[model samples]
Target: MMRKTLTSVWPLFFGLGIIGVCIGAQGSLLGIRAELEGFDIRVTGLLMSAYYVGFLLGSLRAPKILQRVGHIRAFAALTALASITILVHSLIIDPWTWGLMRLLTGFAVSAIYVVAESWLNQAANNRSRGQLLSIYMVTMLAGLSSGQFLLKLADPASFELFTLISVLISLAAIPILITATPMPSFEAARPVSIKALYHLAPTGLIGSFLINTCYAMVLGMGAVYASKLGMQVDEISLFMAVLVVGGMLLQWPLGKLSDRMDRRSVICAAAFAALLFALVSGQTGFAADNRHLLLALLFGGCCFPLLALYLALTNDELTSDQAVGASSTLLLVGGIGATLGPFMISLTMERWGAPGFFWCLAAMSALMAGHAFYRRLIDPLPAAGEPSSFQMQAPSPVGSGLMKSPPSEN
Candidate 1:
């Protein structure tokens, strides 16, 4: 059964994986290059935030575009644009121009993800959907981790690296365009009211917001932090790679643990663990040695899974019919947090130093831990039958449109 399912979804996974490689490399490359070019940390933060701004816009608007052109054409167009956008970064040297490029890149990538995920979802039945999503998530994180090593291929100071990223983006278009798979019909998700979402599951709502904020900060500024700490480019890549690998490794165990008990307990415990790692990574002399990589591994393990936990908790409160709208609302909240996170964390780093990166992470995790404990005390868990099984969430908001009724236990 799993073999047949994997056969059917191979094209989607292949296309998404290539895109992930480009995304991972491009993110670290841009941050490092921005610092090399002497862009102020605050400006660098804005440049990073620009991606989320465009991503938020794309999440809202991409569906209409997908509806008009259909998935294949939309994917082709977006991938082409993404390729062009990366090359544009090499041509222009200004922060504002790079910010604009990042925005366009973000929009293109988000739309591409929506198209790919919609196709994957259409191909999946209820029996295989959960398994399919797990595979997709793993492929994504693996691609991301692999891409970081690509940084060693060329110096950030050169145009060759940018060209390589563009080449990868262009290649990502091929698997989808040449595949025998038929395009799926696109459906617009009804927007859920934020007020209603909050009322249904305040912890999930707020947790999604805060958790993604920390996520964006770490992803956007991590390279910059490492560069500022005097780590060489190779070491920086390894640092980012280790962090992603740790996240991928822990997803299943952490997810299964949450499924057995109150998810809020898991959420609080994870956040507290993240806080501890962040503090250790920030306050100690580990930042300069191999010990920092170990801390990053532990930090990623604790922090990366919170978003999935929160999403499961949110789905617990909503009826099946509300899942689609609720998913969009949760994604919007997350996008908002992501949009603001880079700037805030960047400001902190600018005022303090490299350790400020982990400091900001610690502060956010602390808030999440505190809120989870308070919510557990004040709010009651839903009945066993009410909660959705823990579903693996993609890093992008692409899967929201395909959200369905929770499956019954076997």
Candidate 2:
């Protein structure tokens, strides 16, 4: 399955890998740059959070646009937009300008993801789809993590890194543009209402939102936090890289474990574990020692997998027919959480300084653990039904679209 899928679908994975790298580098660069540019934490939070706002909007709208222009043109146009945004950051460093640029960049990236995953769906069959997705998760993470190291190559304060970011975003378009890929048909997912989803799987819905809120803080504002703490460039790059790699390595093991038993147990356990790591990360002065980087790896390992776990838990409550819509609904819920995370966490950072970042993290983890524990006490999985099989992904609007696609026809 791996061999066949890779042979047929390498271009999509390759192109996406480059995009992942750009995304990783761009976020870290902006966060570090924002600090050096002397933007207040509140403004930085708003700037960073704007991406998720654009992301959520793009995810909702990308299907309609793709249906209008077709996949190739959509990918080309979106990539061009993303590339342009990278350069714009270098030219204009104002908080408001960057906030708007962040929104546009998020929109373009999210739309590209929607189109790219649709392209992959056209390439995969049932037997190979799972393998393809696992590979996809790894490819995206590897690129993302590796991009963090690119920080060492140039000064975050200079135009050079911005140029590199724009070049990579532009370069990612090549494999897709040159390949003769078919446009996969778009049947816009009718996401279940948020109210309905909450009632159906309260833990899943809430857990999805809360866990992703944590993820956004760790990813989007992590560099900013490191910068605030007086970390050098190499340390900041390592910090972000460790978090992504943790998510990459642990997602499958944690996800596959959930498939074997009650998923809420897994979610509860993971949440609690994250709470502990969050405590250690903040209270211990994570910046005080090099060894503390392990906290990020552990925190991310526990938090990232919950995205897939909550999706599975929600699906376990749903009929196969309802699963797809619910998945779309969860994406919206989580995306909103991600969107708010930076701003909310930034408020804490403003009050408490860098420690406020993980204090907010610890508080959220505790909340997640409490809620999951409450759900586990009140609601349990049925003995008669099996949980949905886990789908490992670097979940985004595009990745969510991949998960909601038709079950593989082997």
Candidate 3:
């Protein structure tokens, strides 16, 4: 029984891993390529933001599209579109044109995720749900981390590096295409209203947006920031890797804390810590290469978990149906914040140079802290054992044939 079940779902995991690789390549490539072109920090930020705009739009529309196309067909088509789009980016150097392509890529990737997650949900049984999702999450983080290393393989100056990205994305389709198992139908869920989400867990939803805003800015322009600070290209990649690695390492411990106490407190503490790091790092002007490791550890490990905390916190308040709606709402809001982050951060960098990026980061973190603090006062704790609607499954579970899908509260 175990063997049969494992065989049935391996393709979904493989497919998701491939998709992760594709997404990671884009992020890695963007950091390197933007800097190579001598684009202003502000322009780089704007270009990066464009992708989020597409992602936001696509995520909202993807469920409906999947409902129409069916999972397998939708996955195949979008994967193809995503592959082709990355390849096109290699050929274009114009920031504006690249932004448009990125938007399209974002839309396509969103649909891809929708398809992938839906498939995983369908395949999962109660027993395997947790295992499958752990694999999926690991795959995502590893693929993303590995993608950054690819930057080392190719010269940033040549467009050939992007071709590699294109190739990787194109190849990602093969595992799914060859799988023999029947694909699952898309699960229908109720729609969630944005307004209702705000009312339910205002801090979590808002924090999700702010955290992504900071994350996107760092991801988009951090390489340039490193270069401006006199670090070499390889060092820049390492800087980012450290950040990601630190974040991955801290996910477990910090996650446990959030589960135990008021998540609002966790948000406030993390935000303050991140703000402090950003301030010190920005002021030192990247003088501490040795300390870069520390910055990445602090930001990526402690600061980055803010996103997860935001999700978990939001989930804490929701009913099953409300959880689905709230998660969807958080995605939309986070996407918007991500879209805005790079542009604003880059603009700040343009005016102040190196300090601009960190300053922007600190400012956002401070805002999150403020938001959390205010909400802490406005909202009282729920009585013990109060059932939460937003406690949606952290990820699509593994092993299980079908974990209950969150009831759509729409």
Give lDDT tens digits, candidate 3, residues 1-410: 54676688777667666666657657757766777788777778878888778877877777677668766677788877887887777777788888888888888877777766666666666777656655666777666666666777878778777777777777777787777766665444454667887877778778877888877777667777877777776777777777767766777677777777777887788788888988887877665547866876687776777777777676667766566655666777778788898889888988988888888888898999889888888875842444332222211111111113532211
If both were scored by lDDT, which would come out higher, candidate 2 or candidate 3? 2
Number of the top candidate by lDDT? 1
The positional error of residue 335 in candidate 2, measured at the CA in angstroms, is: 1.4
Alpha carbon lDDT of residue 338, candidate 1? 90
Q: Cα miss at 292, model 1 (Å)?
A: 0.4
Q: How much lDDT does candidate 1 score?
A: 0.84
lDDT of every model, 2 decimals:
0.84, 0.83, 0.71
Model 1 CA lDDT for position 313: 89
Report the C-alpha displacement of residue 156, candidate 3, in angstroms: 1.2
TM-score of 1: 0.96
lDDT (C-alpha) at residue 290 in model 2:
71
State every prediction's TM-score relative to the real structure.
Answer: 0.96, 0.95, 0.89
**Clash tally, candidates in order:** 0, 1, 23
TM-score of 3: 0.89
Query: Which parts of model 3 have CA positions greater than 4 angstroms off?
Result: 1-6, 380-410
